[model samples]
Target: MRAAPARRGRDGADTRARIEAVALELFAQKGVAGTSVRDIALGVGVSEGALYRHFPSKEKLSRELFLTRYATLAAEICAIDAAERELERKLRAVVGLACALFDAEPALFAYLLIHQHEHLGLVPEAPEANVVEAVAQMLRGAGVPPGRVTLASAMALGCVVQPAVFALYGRIKGPLAAQADDIAAAVMVVVEGQARG
Candidate 1:
């Protein structure tokens, strides 16, 4: 007798979620520029057609993945902005939150960090809803000068996020969360320096 035909996605299975998970892993490991739709489909244990049913193209897949990851981080930034009132304290909270997120979802963190420059244009509403904009807006709202907002944001994010990349490469010794204080301190130095100008 012939075996049962293979199933498409089940009612609750949501192959789309699997597609995103596998795509994120491949993108995190190999970079979006290196990973293809075929690779993601293979990793998800689905045919290319199945994957395409979920995502029309590799570029669409990459942008959607980036959007999800960035949104998660953006939500955290929104919380930090709402909770903290001072620039220095808010920055410390941001770094601490970054470290926590890095520890919890390093791949997502790394994926966004790794691909932001290339995929920023691909993702819609990126500039207005991004981390830089969040930080800059926080600063602007706190009476910080417009010119200083950009520099302070750059300094804050770079200080916190660079070490996350280092940790990913094993260049850093401990979990990203463990370096929160150091990261926060370094960010404060930059923010303070920029504010003094």
Candidate 2:
């Protein structure tokens, strides 16, 4: 028996998403500079022309993919109402969220870290800054001094995120799950210090 035909709009979106996913996987595995549009098209089971129809150029596609992921993360982070939580709780939540995201996409995390310098301009500076700002705001709301908030945020990024990034990139050898938890705990200490002082 023949299968039903795909509906236009939803099927089109699904196909695009599949292409993007395959492209991201290839790029992560081979490095964006090493991967080709033909490679992405082959992985997605589509013609090169079709890939071009969806993404004009490989660089443009890469930028769009990164931006799309970052936007989704930013939205998730923004959705957390830090105003309702204590500073320590809010900071913990942020670290937890980051860990969860990294766990869900370790390859993507590795790719980002590997290419961070090359794509520094494409990085969503605002989204990251927003996360720091949210932490600072939460600390202020909890009656912590502004100076402490900045220091806490810096420490959290350095201790939690930097190490997690390294872990994802395989620069350090260990279980990522355990490392993520430890990083979150370390970040919480910094937050707690800010809350108490």
Candidate 3:
């Protein structure tokens, strides 16, 4: 029997990973509309056609990148919400996780953070894969009224997200994790104040 032809390295899983990493960096640096398929192909040292084999279009790649990573983070938050009893502890854990992710994977985290509005509407409302819904569940578990959960969740999430945004822009210095406690506290204020009102 004839030996099977070897698979090209550039057409393998490693190439897909490289394409995603480079696409993320480019998308974060230059808005999704600004980063072209050619830019990603060049960054990955592959032909544009090769990148297409991995992702049919830049929009599809961006969508997959945003949805998957966002779902990962949302699932983690849902896990924390499930494990922690109190709102305070859950907020702390969520804030800490966000900061740690931002510090550890700035490009991936920044891409998710900066481009949320562009893709968030496409995200399902399931708490297991939606951070806002997950946080709202936490608030509701703590006795926040149904009417206020959405606004409260948004406010509390902003406590962590805004600082990350500031850090991304260089307005804030040092590791984002360094400010986790303060951010978590601010989140509590939002939750507690919402509960009171």
Candidate 4:
């Protein structure tokens, strides 16, 4: 039996989504500067004109990817923050959720990792987008002084982000959910030590 012919979407939303997905995947595998409209169009099985119809330029596509992905991750963080009480529990839950997000959408994860320095400025500069602020607030609630909390928050965040970076590179084995407990333990150690000092 032969496979049926693919159905092209009429609403245009499907094509737009496919363009973004293929573009992000290509950008992740090959840097955004390295990938072209033709490449994204080819990956999506559409014409370069169709890619342009969805995104005016490759830079525009990259920016859209960042804004969309960052908003999604920010919402997930907010949900975790609202439900969890303790600092350690919140940290673990966020990290575990982040890992799952990364696992499910590695291309978006890689795109952000590769373009962070260039693209972070474009993401909304809200408290929800700032992990360090969340950590600092948690520290303040736990009795750390305001000025000192920033440093501790930064350090604690390193515990969560650095391992995820390594995991992206295949240096760390298995799913991130598996490492949530250890990551939380390490983060708490850093936070608590700074609180004591």
C-alpha TM-score for every candidate: 0.85, 0.76, 0.92, 0.85
lDDT of 2 at 138: 55
**Residue 59 CA error for candidate 3 (Å)?**
0.6
Per-residue lDDT of 69-184 in model 4, one digit per residue for the tens? 77677766666767888777877887787778777888887787778787777666564764445556567776677767888877877787788889889999888778888888
Pairs of residues at least 3 apart in sequence or in different chains that clash in candidate 1: none
Q: Write the per-residue lDDT of candidate 3 for residues 1-197, one digit (tens) a residue.
A: 23333455434878898998999999999989999999999999999998898899999999999999888888999999889987788889999999999999899988998898889999999988887888888899998999999999889888888999999989999999999999999988889999998
True-structure Cα RMSD, model 3: 2.4
Please identify model 4 stretches exceeding 4 Å from their true place: 1-10, 130-144
Q: In terms of lDDT, which candidate is strongest?
A: 3
lDDT for each residue of candidate 2 in 117-178, tens digit (9 for 90 to 100): 56556554564334455555555666667768788667767786687667666786755655
lDDT of 4 at 47: 88
What is the full ranking by lDDT, best candidate first?
A: 3, 1, 4, 2
* lDDT of the candidates, in the order given: 0.78, 0.69, 0.90, 0.77
Worst 10 residues of 4 by lDDT: 1-10
Q: Write the per-residue lDDT of candidate 1 for residues 11-98, one digit (tens) a residue.
A: 2257888888788888889988789888888888889998887788998888888876776667677778888778667877878788
Model 2 misplaced stretches (Cα beyond 4 Å) = 1-6, 116-151, 169-175, 192-197
Q: Indicate the worst ten consecutive residues by lDDT in candidate 1.
A: 3-12
Q: State the lDDT at 128 in candidate 2.
A: 38
